[model samples]
Target: MKRIFFTLIVSVSLLFLTSSAESIDNLYLIGVVKKISHNKVTVNVKSNVCRGKKDFNISPHIKIKLEEGDFIRFQINSSTCKEKNLKILKIMKIHKPRMEK
Candidate 1:
């Protein structure tokens, strides 16, 4: 009985550790706004791992005006290493630094 209980506990602990390791991490991407509609925005993502156009649903609570061809940085809730299954959590516009004469 003692051996059986110990084995069960060890198995459960290993299972928990593996699941946590498999969990996704938040992803940050820099992109150019391609289009903005009612509740979704399309962006041309420029990144080493994930590139090309991707559409993300906008959070209803977030109210920010975006235009086509605007450079922006956005955060996704979580993504796979390949950046699949993306959901936008935050968005910010990237402004170029003014050149000093």
Candidate 2:
């Protein structure tokens, strides 16, 4: 039936759209909490290339309490090379305690 064929086509199209999205990950050396607005954030992130695709929202895996100096690894799902297109999936902060040499 035509109805059955149409339903199959719609399902296949949805699957392809979801699977084609890109993925990316990057390390962010956290600085001051610049601001928090909506689902977005602005922080001074330090990395080899200071500017890259990054997500503003902190991931759920990140502990509720964090400090300014913590270094965090951020994972995002997005289209490559677009700033606003990235979505954060996971966040792991690095704890570095100074060692006396």
Query: What lDDT does model 1 reach?
Result: 0.78
Per-model CA lDDT versus the true structure: 0.78, 0.53
Tens digit of lDDT per residue, candidate 1, span 1-101? 99999999999999999999998777788988888888888988897656888888877777777777778888887664344545677886664434579
Highest lDDT: which candidate?
A: 1
* TM-score for predicted model 2 compared with the true structure: 0.41
By summed lDDT, which 10 consecutive residues of candidate 2 come out lowest?
A: 23-32
Candidate 2 wrongly placed segments (more than 4 Å): 1-40, 48-55, 60-64, 79-81, 96-101
TM-score of each: 0.64, 0.41
lDDT (Cα, 0-100) at 64 in candidate 2:
47
Model 1 misplaced regions, further than 4 Å = 1-23, 81-85, 96-101
Give the alpha carbon lDDT tens digit for every residue of 9-48 in model 2.
9999988887765433543343334455556656555554
